[model samples]
Target: MLYKKECKISSEGFVIPDFDFDSADAVIPISTPSITQYEFDSFQLYLDLLDAMKHDKSSNFYPSILIKALKMFTASIISQKNNIPNELLESYDTPGTLLSLIDPNTDKTVFLEALHAAIAWTGAVKNNSAFSVPEFILFLIETSVYALSDPNFQYDRNIGNSTVALLRNILFHSNDAKFHFINNRGVELFSSLYLEVVGDTLKDYIIIVIINSLDVSPTPPFNFVKFVENPLLKSVFGYNLRSATSLEIRLALAYVKISPECALSFLNHIEIESSGIEFLFASTDTQVLLLELFEFLVTCSNETVVSIAEKKIQWNVFLPHIPMSFDSKLMKKTIQVAVNLFKIGHYKILDTLILKVLLEMMTIGNIKIKHRAMDAIRILINSGSPHSMDSIIGHNIISKICNFLESDRKDIFKFCFEMLLFIIQFALDGKCPRKVRDQLYEAEFEAIMEEVCGCELNEELANMADILKEKFDQLVAESETLEMAELENNHEIIEEEDYDDDEENEFHDNHFDNMNYYQQYAQNCMKGIEEEDESENESDDEEEDEWVDADEFPID
Candidate 1:
């Protein structure tokens, strides 16, 4: 294979003794053959290939020539020691025209081969400043889209993979390429292609395209809200959440950052199914994305949307899985979400569940998790309802805080102190139930406060401890006052009950005397009545005898 060779020549008409081909000043000697006859014939053949491809718009006249031209163009750009020739670089324009020949209904074997060539060519010239023209990049993207749009183009096939590779190369080359891709309905088209593609590889490529398209800083030019609204995009996101690879999950996460609206929409879809939360707890990458989306929703400051998210996402189902999450970063975000929920006051039912998780996390070795757990506890104690705050006081929460207060970790100590201070203040202010205050008292709450108050600490911890001690005293005073009030009330009730008992006993005695008097009087009356009855009976007996004698005489 004869080829053109260039040798550096000195200005003195003698070849440089040490000819450095890489030197900028090196030049080709006029005496040296820049092209042999064979090289000239090869160049001519390359030109003919380009011309043939240019005219073969339908690709009917030697379709292989398009593939040959694509390879030759890529190879020329890569192998050239100097600048790629204008003819070779300009040959990049022919692929798009040849791609137009591909029918969505036709077999795509040749069309895919041509696309692979274009991908190679684009990747080869990606770094070449001279070839990074808008026109060329759009042509590469359009050709890739056309090939990908083929209904018969099997993504698992070599052709479909090549087309995706080509598109990725073009889209990643520059922000402009990505912008043009999105502006030209590239997302819509790729989303459609993604649904039709079967293999993970093609799906991954599509995900990368969407990610790279929206990955620009300071606002990408794409319409992310509309992108998210697409059914295909939603399905892709849903699929990624459930079963896609980690890289795909990451790409979906990056895509979600494009817009708060997009994140909300994505989250809404994830919220539709428990499988989404299952995947979140199962995969570390997806969990990160879930947290980010959650943060976005919380910070967006739209209460209606946040409430909708709270309702749609089963926080009860998700809360129990926090302890099972092994990733500290993920656990931190989970705590953040819990804290935000507490701040929002929507998912109040999760307060106890979150409190338990936070307490459990406080015992973990991970400082971030522990810190976030404290933050969540502080938020709940500060802003949570009295009932919810009271719920945290149990399960040895006081003991946990006291133990954390004794830790060597300053963050833990500080956080624990702040939380304790909040709890004590909450108790003192009577925001918490009396039961909680008593529980704190039973947990050696005063001793813990005094221990913190006496320790030499940072200004913040010391100040917090002082406040906690003052509040603790006030809480104790109030509790004692309440106890005295209850005792006084009980004493008054006892005195009143004793008086009622004495009065009832006296009434019973008086009623008993009256009944006895009545019985005696009745007995005397009965004795007199018996005497009267005897007299009346004698008189009636005499009258009856007389009447009976008269009747007997009459009968006789």
Candidate 2:
């Protein structure tokens, strides 16, 4: 604290310690008339603060002190200009010492100023490179990122642009430093920004930014198959990953596009400790994102799918969130992904969760979600989970699938048929529930089969007829086998009754033969009479019987 007699200031007004400026070996005396040199000297203090910040980041002094220093130093530089244009100070690029006026306790004000200042500084440094733009931009971004306690930061244009620029820079330069930046701040800042601005009026711009971000390549980790384990990114974008609408999905797909490597990473992130879909899949806004994600996942390798199914259980998020919108583009992509995942044995990830969620959501979901849900459910029932077949079949998923076949939607009916076909195939492989299989054989499932058959028999529903026939035949065969077994058992019981002698046996055989002959004769007579009679002719012929015969002879 060695100061010249001229440098006099009370301890209370100076939040920054006197020792803080000691690092500036080239400090100019305060009495010097050259204010520019003083500004530069004070600017040196800013550098010392940066150094100090790097070492000890305790928030002892509120951000107001930093704001005050910026105001005082920048003002000192601006005032020295003899005649400054007022517009220059108020321009979008230079809001001028406004940062100093902010009260640190008022975080919203500080946040806005800090955001504006960082943006303005970036532009200012680029326009006027008497200072280093990269270094200054980094510092400003660093400061703004630190001031994230305020949720309102994302709404400002300056903040939005700066945040996008920072991300762009990181994506363009996929070096260690930038990667770490994205890995650390990418999820929190970017996701928070998205959350704040998701449904806001300027969502168009935000979505465009996301689209651009996803377009970055060669995707994270240089491969699209590895699971990314970043907590912050997962926390923020996981829900968005399953958005019901196209916009949120488009944004999520952006991350996957740049780094196909992110596909497994994201799936891993969403995987919960236990099985069950999160409420996010229930969100009407993001389920479409989940569908798109699965579509992307299908493009991944087999080993990737296998690894995901083994460790992850989050596919349930997609179960409840079927997108009914039927974007041919998205649907095409989704069907491909689902097929691939099934081929690779990822169906176990869905299992009972798919059936449970779909059953609850089918009637209640939007047309689009419902449609997508039906598509996924059908695929699931048919795919057959090798590891979890018992769980799937044990839950009565087959009955529900049969019910979906009766939906009025032709697309749904066709999907249900395809599903039934798959179910038959899987059953042949012995994957169906034991109880359900027995019911199919016992003719007990006929009512449901009849309804499904009716749906398939329509000329317009011919596409589903083959599958319906296959299921029907399988069920009928099972029923007939049971019936034959029952009949055999009854015949054995009748034969068990013994006769005392040969003569008694002979009488029993004659009796049985006569009864059989009479039954045949009676059956033939009944058949002929039914064929010959007609409603009109029978009414005319029987009219006499109905009248005279009853009136004249009934009493006798």
Q: What are the per-residue Cα lDDT tens digits for candidate 1 across 57-89? A: 675645565555544543443234244466654
For model 1, state the Cα shift of residue 288 in Å.
1.5
On the 0 to 100 scale, the lDDT of residue 140 in model 1 is 49
For model 1, give the 10-residue run with minimal summed lDDT: 13-22
Per-prediction backbone clash count: 0, 27
Which has the greatest TM-score?
A: 1
Model 2 residue 115 CA deviation in Å? 12
TM-score per model over all chains: 0.55, 0.39
